[model samples]
Target: MPGAVLAPTSAPGYPAHVRIHEVGPRDGLQNEPATLPPDVKAEFIHRLAAAGLTTIEATSFVHPRWVPQLADAEQVFPLVRDLTGVRLPVLVPNERGLERALAHGAREVAVFASATESFARANLNRTVDESLTMFTPVVARSLDAGVPVRGYLSMCFGDPWEGDVPVTQVVRVARRLSDLGCAELSLGDTIGVATPGRVAELLNALAAAGIPADRLAVHFHDTYGQALANTLTALRHGVTTVDASAGGLGGCPYAKSATGNLATEDLLWMLNGLGISTGVDLERLVATSLWLARRLGRPSPSRTVRALSHQEPRE
Candidate 1:
């Protein structure tokens, strides 16, 4: 029942406002071992909206065989689709996935791509070029339908199979997605091995390739506890959009070594201290994560959630 304490002073030169692209429903739940019922998933999203998260990744349109946890995307989406002033984006792996999302009235969609051939093969069963080929039409068609598409470039920092990824390689794939009409790209540190300097390298290289910071989002995992450092580096360089999951509930099923996405509450706590507006109620968000932790049968991995919820978060 305790609340979060904001930082006493402000930091300099960070974005005045950051758009937290909430991925708790889709990315967070997809990696869970338990498959929550559609209604529970919808309620989770509703809580996030009530906590003032404007952009939420609701679900994925990928085949059920790929991610069984999110198989009920169709049924879960409608429950929160009518929420006002919220942008719900769904993950669409390919054209078929896009079709599924469209049929269910999805207004925003995202395509997942890998920066290395190893991840492209393991995650999507395609080579790097082949996966891009698959996404080309998906992006084009989504734009044609007036639905904005977000491109997820996973393994931007390091890959378990391929080791460190070169900045140029990421920029190349990112430019391809951007050229295909993706309105934004979420650069992912899939294995959470990114250092602040490496993050700076990629962002700089992408800028050199004509990909602006405004059109880029940073998605980092916490395997090495570097997600926050990597994210701040991106923010310092003028990137405003960040992808985070509630309660730090996520890991890549395809890449076993990966950890949870950056915790939304943890990120909110830092931004609040820095005086960067995110429009999220930290008290409500801590409460929401505590609400979900009970459902997941474990305490949240997020430091802020645990600290604010008084460790147990139950009276």
Candidate 2:
């Protein structure tokens, strides 16, 4: 969104490829006020796959009681489960959530952990240690069943109740989750207060703690308009995986100040400029977001989506 509306330009210090873990169907939709039907939700997943997003977080099996917006996880998962070359990972809160996703043919699952104790109690209703303990068996069992487990460490950069989370505190929880057998860990800036320097510091601390860049992903929110900047810093630190939401839809249900995630289209525009290979079609992705926006009765919050939507097509 910061770049000019022109052809993608190549840059140095970036890899030839970056993996975008699209979270619109799960993290994005879960925070929305509308309760979309399962069939429509399934179509959204299919459209994202068609747009070339290989890893799409389909839905959460965290029970209908907690997140009524994604209440139809059982119905939504099956609609696009067989999409070829696409991996759909569902969010599993505990062992029961894992089984529910497994029953729906989930090949990958993610467990949520909080870097700070305050957020841990707020989001998971457990302390930092207690949440990790709850996730230990979930990660173990998922691995035993040949399903890769991803660890989502929220409030990595900042938290609402706990001001300015220490880098050391994040690394401590991150190390424990990684040790618990999480194949990948997504660091979340839950309140969108992360700046470029802070993002670099956290990545550096994690590396110092023995967490390789390859096993780490960054999930950023755009509340302060720093998502792209923070993400660029992570990229320079060799973080290859990024979590984004289509149409800029998502917010923390626990943290009221938290806003939408890094828009998938906005991230793609920057990555494409850097000559990174995501295998995602930007036009298709923008179109997908537009389609979803119409259903939600609002315009997409993504700057790229809005710009490209109104741009003149070339001959």
Candidate 3:
């Protein structure tokens, strides 16, 4: 069941254009215990570009001690720096992170804030307001430097420390980020506790807060195997962009038992089956996933990839 081929596409109400922002390089590998070489990271990005993923979150510019896996970000970014038609965005925790990212010639930057108070405190070591205050300068600096910034709002579904995050809180943080000059705000189901109903409710509130669905992206983890379902719900609500990991290699360090982000191969498989124009190559994506999986010494978590690779031979 983990690697089953999806059924064929049918006519649906979904949009024809959906943007998939590949997160395997940064979010997917940050939590991994073993350190991968800079060249390996570059090869992974190369394969991703080959797969037709137009936008990729290349790395995070956090302190080396906090995430040693991404310590080589400064070193790794310049290797793939000249990729045309692909936006390589890096995550920045503060002004210092932004400075480092700009030094590496990053044209886009992403800053993260959480909806749940507990998660905000644990992930950023500060309160929600404090995190926003910290990002204000980062956002302003990026804007001043002509860099586009994307905001990530985590824990929209539920929190490990606090269950069932309030919709009001989600809206508040999203609005604050939007007000802080973030070009886009991605709502994250960090713990994968969201259902379709909760997603609709949260989107409704965000809409009321003057944050359009077009400026929104959905980041769902497949912990409960509901990442695809949640993504479909967001698409129905007019969300055009999504954040997924290649080969399903992602997890939040702040949440216990949190699975990785939705796999890129799996998402592309689903989108291809739905006849949606994601402009992604499923076969190349699967190959890249396999390569990364071998480097990590773990089997790929993408069900579709596993299925396609293990298809039975017809005699």
Candidate 4:
């Protein structure tokens, strides 16, 4: 088991202790061109936990045909199954994926649904409604097995093919996921086109629909450089959970126009500056991202990582 320690603190317009759901191992690496071995993936989780990330998304149980990078979920889960103080949630697109995750004694699982018809078709080969319908049983069986489920709704702000996605449409899909027993729902701005105002509007709508801010998580991309700003807006609305990838290592393979997710280091930098406690050690977290960046044969895309790497050493 890795270390689980954090310097306690708080931030403005945010919860005293925000839950940073580290999605680097799964969501972050899944889009990388190179396929990281299961052992490497497990080590990444261990490093993240050592850096004090409590909820690390470990892997996806979706078929290799879809996400070949995480095809080794079975092998990956066993290596980090005993890590203390960390929640390893695997993504399961359907019942078959759920069964695979459960076979490995998974305690938490996530299902992804798209908010727009275009993204739904591009990513899942189904309509948005159909994707949600498919996840109903997946969520039900996971809950029945006593495994808490997290739901991801992508393209909540805008879609490349469809143009602007109305807030009403996003709320509708969100409500369905809430009704389906997802303990938490992560709203994704898949294309990084969302502004802070739009984020606030969406959260407001979800709140009005009986979904509390605590039940929602925000996942933003830095495409238009709005991820951090949108995240701050979400925090102001009382969204405590946020999804970020270490080293900023992900882009939507289905959405070619999309960029990488908000970097965990960048998010941590903001949280730390605001005195928001995420239970994550900023310096150690940057080191972990630097290590992973070496394995991928590229410099990290995170601004904080770049800045820190170039800073003059203190005596």
Model 1 ranges off by over 4 Å:
1-3, 311-315
Candidate 2: C-alpha lDDT: 0.91
Give the 10-residue window scoring lowest on summed lDDT in candidate 2.
1-10
lDDT of 1: 0.91
Number of the top TM-score candidate: 1
Pairs of residues at least 3 apart in sequence or in different chains that clash in candidate 2: none
- Rank by TM-score (best first): 1, 2, 3, 4
What's the best-to-worst order under lDDT? 1, 2, 4, 3
Clashing pairs in 3: 2-303, 3-303, 250-260
lDDT of each: 0.91, 0.91, 0.89, 0.89
Model 4 misplacement above 4 A: 1-12, 310-315
Off by over 4 Å in 2: 1-5, 311-315
Give per-model TM-scores. 0.97, 0.96, 0.95, 0.94
How far residue 290's Cα lies from its native spot in candidate 2, in Å, is 0.8
Q: Estimate the TM-score for candidate 4.
A: 0.94
Model 4 per-residue lDDT tens digits across residues 1-315 = 022223435554577768999999988988999998889899989998998999999999998999999889999999998998889998999999999999998999999999899889999999988998899999999989999999999999989999899999999999999999999999999989999999988998899999999999999999999999999999899999999998899988899888999999899878876778788877778788888887899999998887776533221
lDDT for model 4, please: 0.89
lDDT of 3 by residue, 1-315 (tens): 335446757648898889999999999999887789999999899889988999999999999988888999989999998999999999999999999999989999999999978988998999999999999999999999999999999999889888889999899889999999999999999988888888999998889888889999999998888999989999999999999999898898778768889998878777777878888877778878877877899888888778776643111
